[model samples]
Target: MNFSSDAAILYWSGSNINLNFKGSEISAILKDSDTANYYNVIIDDSIVSKIQLNTSKQTYLLASGLSYKKHKLQLFKRTEWDKGTTSFYGFETNEKTKTLPKSKSKKKKIEFYGDSITCGYGNEVQNGKDSGTGHFENNYLTYAALTARHFDSQYSCIAKSGIGIMVSWFPKIMPEVYDLINPNDPNSKWDFKKYTPDVVVINLLQNDSWIVNLPKNEEFIKKFGNQKPTEDFIIKSYENFVKSIRAKYPNTYIICALGNMDITKEGSKWPSYVSKAVVNLNDNKIYTHFFMYKNTPGHPKVNEQAAMADSLIAFINEKIKW
Candidate 1:
């Protein structure tokens, strides 16, 4: 996050700006790189509305007609980095109402490094046509976010739509962008000590399964020229990525997760690959948890995402000391 000129830049999915104030209404000064970005206006702990951003800087009406009492407001970014960045200026309150400091954050912290599943892509879709505007993506409704809310843990997400461990829909994989403070800036480094998570969940490999199969795909060709990565190569790549994360958070529990996609399907080998990587590490702290395949077209919907959160919570309860 870059806080300059009395404003901050929210560049990734799930990033937010929270304010507590006593007023009947409140508005925010904001700007978006893309005019079509989305944001969830959460009052207190419940989401009240989903607002779209404009390309130019302006004051956006967040909430109105509330009791003239203290209220908590959280503006959560719903889209990922590729959706665009948001610049937040400040909030405006009616009358003599003043802004108050937010409540203390939870001591338990969890960091998620995943893909579209964690970004809640296609979550808002109903019957057919599994695609929509960026409004369809809501990070707050994802299994990752639900899991964090359940544990009352501070959430840190670094996820993109088509990212994977071995290969992505794009040339940049998780290993290359995991440590950057800004996803698009290779020179930017995230200070590990700034926020050390007690638990790190890595949900990936769904994209790799498809992309690696198409060895001639642009993404595959860019990541691995001419040759398709063998099973051994895939397993090794997953291991190396986890090891790099372990090097950063030595004592933190690392959950090497796969997905509710074809990656974890009945006959799929991605689960075995993740299990193999965990066995190779031989570290008691690192564990494997794979969500069952949804067996439907497109991404997992909200209910499916909820099921995943429930499964993950159950796994965490049984395996870890959380």
Candidate 2:
């Protein structure tokens, strides 16, 4: 059967499905046939459970131990497209089920832009080694998601593994595809008007620091028209990118953040560059923050992500008061 025909797709990290039912148990017919993926089963907007999606399982019980009354269920795909796509055939409830309209999201909304750290790459791995697989990824526990959930706000995560502000591990950089609906598809375009966040957080520059010093290929040079990337060049590129985002979101608060990686190290010079870019932009609404953290191997674990989230949440609370 063509599974995609009848089912709603949870294609990327942060994609989700919601339902309201009057039942004690709720289950979903889900399939993530290739790579490992994860889902956040949120019931009644309070109780949350992390479920692992695998090829062997066709039906996943999202919530079983619930009181027999009207309740709300939200299933969030906590893994990126690289982890694989999940198809939700439908929901199964012991009693009568009612389809819920996609409720209007919270009045407050936030969007995050970055790389592996924002994507929660390898965050679930117990070992520190970069295993280079989807099994270790769990975007649900990332700092970005944690902060949004803490505020009971809506969120969008436009992040991927090894992506940078100016240079990515792959061919595309954040600037080139930030407007795309599908992070992996070059032809896709996202309409910024569909949902505007009250605040925008930019946590890039990690990969640029690592890749800028290296020799560039002919294609890379042609795309950027810069063979030797200097500190000034990086700052200017970043400032321009922020301007582009501002063009789309004129009044939104923009926070340029760095670290939870080596970007905080004095020698890295990344934090300085980010600060300089925001200063050069000269927008009082745009701010810069540096996270003092160790450059852990692979990615940050849950506890580490929570620490990052706490710091961010504290700042947003102070600055935006939301």
Candidate 3:
């Protein structure tokens, strides 16, 4: 988030603001890159509404007719960077409302570096188009978010749709953009010491599975020199990416995970690539896990995402002490 200005710019999915206030209604002074961006209006714990942004600055009515005693409001960015950026100026409440003092606490941090699955792409759609409007995406509904919420962990996500470790649907891949504060700005850098996670999850390889099969893909040729990447190359690429992360946080537990996609289908070699990479690293803190394949087309739906979260939450409870 760019906080230099009065209107802080929120750039990633699940980037959000929480307000505790005693009021009958509340409004927010916000603006966006465009109308494509959407935000989840969460009161207390449940999501009450989803809103879009406008080009011009305006006060967006978030909720009304509250109990006027105490309320927890979360204005969360549900869409990804591609959906457009949002600038938050602040919030406004009715004349009788009183803003509560900010609370402080230390919480365990968990960071996720993944693709569309982590971004919650198409989670709301029911057998809809492969790519729809921003309406269908909700990062808060993803397994990553669910796991974070389950442990009351502070969350940070560096993810985009169609991205992989080796190659992506576009020319840019995760390795080239992972450290960036702004994904499109290669010059932008994120200081790792600012937020270190006790547990780090890397859910990738879905796009790589599809892109590698398409030898004619523009990005494939650009990355693989007009040939499919070998098994050794793929494993090495995974190793190098995980190694880069370890270099940043020496003691953090790294979960090198793959699939809930065809990448983990019965005959697929992608899971092996991840396992072999972890084996080759010989790192005690790093572990590999593969999500069960969905056995259907398109991204995982809401129920499927819940199943993934359930599986992952169990894995975390068993494998990680923190």
* TM-score per candidate: 0.97, 0.88, 0.97
Q: Which clashing pairs does model 1 show?
A: none
Q: For candidate 3, report its TM-score.
A: 0.97
Candidate 2 per-residue lDDT, tens place, 63-100, comes to 77677778888887767766766777888755455555
Model 2 lDDT-worst window of ten: 1-10
* Residue-level lDDT tens digits of model 3 in 1-322: 7774587888888898988898888999998888988999999888988898899999999999788688888888888888777889999877898989865644788899999988988888976445646888889989999989998988888899999999999888999988987887888788999888999999998999889999888998899877898999999999999999999999999999887878899999888889999999999999988899998778888888899988888999999965
TM-score of 1: 0.97
Clashing pairs in 3: none
* Model 1, runs deviating above 4 Å: none
Clash number for every model? Answer: 0, 0, 0
The true-versus-predicted C-alpha distance at residue 252 of model 1, in Å, is 0.6
Q: Tens digit of lDDT per residue, candidate 1, span 1-322? A: 7666877988878898888898888999998889768999999899999999998999989998988889999899888888878888888766767888878988999999999999888888887347646978888989999999999998889999899887888778889998986788899888898889999999988899999889779988888899999889999999999999999999999998888988888989889988998999999999999888888898888999999999999998889858
Alpha-carbon shift of residue 284 in model 2 (angstroms): 1.4
Local distance difference test, each candidate = 0.88, 0.79, 0.88
